[model samples]
Target: MQHAIAILDSGVGGLTVVKEIMRQLPQEKIIYFGDTARSPYGPRPADEVRLFTRQIVDYLAQFAPKMIVIACNTATAVALDDIRRHVGIPVVGVIHPGARAAIKSTRSGMIGVIGTEGTIRSGAYEQALKRISPGLQVFSLACPRLAPFVERGLFGADEAEDVVRSSLEPIMNVPMDCLILGCTHYPFLADAIGQVMGPGVKLISSADETAREVSAILYHKGLLSESADIPLHQFFCSGDPALFKQIAQTWLSEQISITPVIWQVPNIV
Candidate 1:
């Protein structure tokens, strides 16, 4: 096995997970695919999202990865189990790790969650948290506009602050000691979100915990790479390569190459 960890997202959001993985497991090689042309899977129907996710997974499997990470919360909510059952790899998702971190970080037992409408509607984080701590109070808000803004590469822009603040207004009335950025894309808007939520509220990004889970799984499976050389990382997107590459370089702080992959058209036999 090549021992590479493959990751997929609806769009650039998954880079958040990649960032954490690179920081914690610098030796592991990564192959990432983003469905940017049909970005923002959060609003699509479950079946449609599942189909899209499967299509991308089959495409990524060409790399013969040892594991796959479903870095988008909406996709993880709708497609993680289906992909895992058929893919036969150690597949990880952002929901559990994020919920676990939120559960631990909330000292007041009041936690708030913000994510794409599809993710919030799926109740994956709420379910995960309750399964672990039934008594904990959970409040969730669906920010339908956040993901689209992120996909457009508008983080930290002047307009982003107002959009983020408005989307988070619902949760401001709720008393939460911890707030989980339930969607990977939410981290890019954290500054605006933090400004609205104030300093006392702890913001939890699933990236760190999800990375740790990936490390743990690889360690347990004895798939940890022994190569001392700087590992190679490849990125592919189903959208504009230039935009994806620009964001990837800025996010990773390195000049990494991104190859463009188009979704294959099936022959009508």
Candidate 2:
């Protein structure tokens, strides 16, 4: 049996990373778990987020995955180290990849970060960025409403631009060359965000960077899948299966021609 890469997130936001993984490592099997019932983990307490992450990890352990990716920024902020300690497999988080990407993309040394309350509060990006380049300027904001909006699969709605505009008002004139979509869910609203941020500022999503990291880690460990056959990916969620299926199909249909098998994991919650 193929040892799949296990990815866990607060909701459909992690599909961003999944899309990149499918493109970069086509042969690897994937086992993804989305805790949609507790969708917006942004505002939740750190301890609570840690608990929820642990529960999801414990559940995903059944698959005996070769690696684990914490696709949720908020959970990664509070639980990455804990999850690393809990699991023996290679564990990756969205924060550091995103911070590194932002650092590399910015020419002005002025970086803007937009994420959930928990992520912003933890200052994980700020720390990660400063740890590498101490002189860089970092501006962090908590847009608590955006994640929930994306969770509802309304990113394409007409009002999305307006919502993104309002949420980004504070940092509009910050003079940053690049803005990091610190939360995975933010990428779903990337079009609207780009319009709001305008032509000057480049938008960075950790999805691509995180996917690259996964590929490198697997290669270094000699864990890269050698199978020539197409791998079937499995998706599980703790909430509305219909909504999860709809979002997954809409985002991934272009990359994966075969429809994914999605299961509603009621017991995980």
Candidate 3:
């Protein structure tokens, strides 16, 4: 059987990645999982994030995906290697692609990174950037409340603008010419962030870069879809399936079916 690319995030944020995938790899099948019940993995402990990511990976694995993509910045920062080592399938994450894109976009050698608390605190983007360009100056800020706002589907609201402006005010003073939206969820707020940062700064969305990486990987593995028919796309959420479905349809501009992945509470018989 031809397998699909499995993508997961802490919540609907992963759809950003999925959107790019559908656009870039229109022929490829996709299976996406959103851990919405435990959304906003940013503030959670690294171990907790890792545990949750592993559980989601295990669930996605049953589908026999050709590859797995951890579309969440916090999960990629905290749990990527662990999942890679544990899973039989090839695993991809957002940090390297976002870092590479930022490195390529910046002319001033100074770049800014905005992500969840876990991702920023992990220094994943900074480490990835410096690894590519040793002398580059990297500034990272953790926008803890930003993901929650997006997850709640508050992207265009005045409250979102206020939160985005306040969250980005510190980085606006920096002289960075390129900013990486390190969190997958952040792209939903890109307009508000772009307005606050103005046109001088180039904002790099991890979704776009990641989709490119996925294409490259699939090509190298000789796994690119060969079917002439439109590929199948599936979405699963661990929380509020109705809300997730509603937001996804609006965001992706398509009607979609969403299956809820209920986390069963273990019995203590």
Off by over 4 Å in 3: 254-269
How do the residues 182-232 of candidate 1 rate in per-residue lDDT, one tens digit apiece? 999988888898999999899999877899999999999988998886777
The C-alpha local distance difference test score for the whole of candidate 3 amounts to 0.88
Best by TM-score: 2
What is the C-alpha lDDT profile of model 2 across 1-269, one tens digit per residue?
A: 88999998999999999998999999989899889999889989999999999999999988999999999999999999999999898999999998888887888999999999999999999999999999999999999889999999998899999999999999999999999999999889999999999999999997878999899999999999988889889999988899999999888878754557778776654
Q: What would you estimate as the lDDT of candidate 2?
A: 0.91
lDDT score of residue 136 within candidate 1: 93
Ranking under TM-score, best-scoring first?
A: 2, 3, 1
Mark the 10 consecutive residues where model 2 has the least summed lDDT.
255-264
lDDT of 1 at 232: 72
Candidate 3 lDDT by residue in tens digits, 135-174 = 9999999989899998998886888889999999888889
Candidate 1: Cα lDDT at 36: 86
Segments in model 2 whose C-alpha atoms lie over 4 Å from true places: none
lDDT of each: 0.86, 0.91, 0.88
